[model samples]
Target: MHKNAFAIHGDIVWSKNPKELQTVEGGYLIVVDGISKGVYPQIPAEYQGITVVDRTGMLVIPGMSDIHVHAPQYGFRGLGMDLELLDWLNTHTFPEESKYANPEYAWRAYQIFSDDLLHSATTRAVVFGTMHVDATMTLMGKLETTGLKTMVGKVNMDRNSPDYLCEKDAATALEDTKKWLDEVEDSHFENTKPILTPRFTPTCSDELMEGLGKLRAERDLPLQSHLSENLSEIDWVKGLCPWSTCYGQTYEHFGQLAGDQPVIMAHCNWCPDNEVEILKENNVFVAHCPQSNAQLSSGIAPIRHYMDLGMNVGIGTDVAGGATLSMFRAMADAVAVSKLRWRLVDQNLAALSTEEAFYLATVGGGKVFGKVGSFDEGYEVDALVLDDSQIKTPLELTLAERLERYVYLAEEGGRIVEKYVAGRRVL
Candidate 1:
């Protein structure tokens, strides 16, 4: 290997495309200066003296990305599953998020959440924080130490929220957001960045949205927010913004669709064809939360359709809306939900396959971070070393088959043996 390069050997697998899986047994994955050199069957003679870490029995795959997760909501995951979207938020989400106003509470809750995330397979995420600036800073501070690259947004909601959680006004929301951005800038966090979050159309007033859109333009910041995730939510957006043609149009009207930076919209389950076109035209990234959609009884997203349209798509845990932080669960759930959508909702679309789901969890989601989620020479070396030996099988399995089993069956305990972000080991 080169002077500064290191290599790790394993059963390697990564995505070449949404439908393609690239696997290599006994592969040598070379990393130099926190970037992947290449995966080779043998260490080349030109690079003979570098260190090699032997991860012989493990499977190396790209680190998963969760493009949309609520960091504050992580404290209450797996609770309030019986309620639908609006009711669930009212009963559980708003109340839980409101607790973050206390800096101590934010620290305590975020510590646990950050620790769990560090241990999980996700190496990068776009996270949502509560409206409290100090609490959001607290959250980002904890996440920064985990060596995972993340974008955390302090939520902006000036209307249609509980008194405790909503911002006082659009001006206050904008000012607070600017302050948060300024604080984040001053801190100079290595791995954590700030994102503009507008909550959603129902919660953000026209003025708040407009201000946020302008902030996005001026600062050239990325944004994350909910889209047409539920039918009731869509209707609420319709009534909230009568001048807008569709739910997506309301965001477009206020210039929240896309600016200098890309936008990440969670759960485009109910996006109409026009809205779909708008998302495509604007180059918006969709964060598909399959478990959250099923848990909250929101309609399933046409992810296959999005893929067919060449839209940027990624998977998300969605925290409390989704019950787990495991991207493996998200990958499996994506395929399962797509099967339901194919058989019951729309017969014309093909169900997602294992390869497609894996791609969404990896490279597709990594698009937001730029050149991540794969080991395709020069891609950032964020990866996971999976120990799936606990998964017993009677017959021989292909690398793809083993990955499929791990995606569906691996649980929280001891599945990932090691984790790396930018070729630096984090776990």
Candidate 2:
């Protein structure tokens, strides 16, 4: 028998494309040595006797991926919703992140975050850590034990931040970042990797961005940061980069937009046509964070417009800016906010359907990690077995309908009865 091979029998669902969802009820999803062999109506003859973990009457789907989230801000998820982006960062986020400098506090906070993530439906995440190198490393160590593929970034901010939380200068910030990257390189972490993070244009000086861009290219590391999240933030960026045409141009000028590695920019709520073109030209990943947008009054992102333009897109919980770490809630919020945008802001742009939301939560977000978040052949096997018996319904519903209900109604860390990452059961 193949050591890591197994078969799961249940209602298998996955996105064949953004507009199509493939569903196979009463089927077998085969995993051979951590790679999916595709879903079959019956066990193939070659693997007839392989171990079949029966999950009949339940939902078997690809595990979700959170392409953007802040690990240090998880402790204050529901606070500061009343404030806008800039004020909230000063009032709640900065003060909270400053606490991460203490190794013990960081370990405790990251432990809670990691434990919740392990039980949740996410198997992959792109996370943001604070500027403190030791504490960021601690966050990485805690998440490494979850068996989930994660890209953790140590944030760089040399200006426009609280004195307690800000780095001394561009050189100091780059040196500390290099030290963090070196630690990540020397660590024995199997599932955790480092990404370059510049907090944003207002906080990251030109010199710091230039240095980070150079480090990103030299290390061939992926990058993540915020962009055009709020109107005030966009205005601030325009003032900071007076020579740049748009907020996205600030990053583009620094060679931080795209290259050999992926770049994920969160909350492009106010990116204009030119900025959108820049993002598309570079094939940048846009992480649409609806709940965060709503909480901070940051305005709704034109997710449907981005999808229509064939832009790379994904969903993120965004932690403290949002209220919860549940990607399901994020997906639902995406669908809800799109409706409002279509009705009130732009009639030409249509609302996102639950199906499209699911696509963003799965295949779209998985694109960041490459060939992930699908049950297609040759893809890595990351599955979530959900027990929906408690979500009682009197009438029969299609598997898709059941999944839609779960997206909106299922409780995080509770309904996911079994979790698998690369065909290995971690929960």
TM for every model, in the order presented, reads 0.98, 0.98
lDDT of 1 by residue, 323-374 (tens): 9999999999999999999999899999999999999999999999999999
lDDT of each: 0.92, 0.92
lDDT of 2 by residue, 234-262 (tens): 88888889999999999999989768799
Against the hidden true structure, what lDDT does model 2 obtain? 0.92
Q: How far out, in Å, is residue 355 in model 1? A: 0.6
- Estimate the Cα RMSD of every predicted model relative to the unseen true structure: 1.1, 1.2
lDDT at 77 for candidate 2? Answer: 86
Q: TM-score of predicted model 1?
A: 0.98
Q: Which ten residues in a row have the lowest lDDT in candidate 1?
A: 408-417
Task: Extract clashing residue pairs from model 1.
Answer: 1-47, 1-48
Q: Which ranges in model 1 have alpha carbons more than 4 Å from their true place?
A: 1-3, 412-414
Off by over 4 Å in 2: 1-3, 412-414
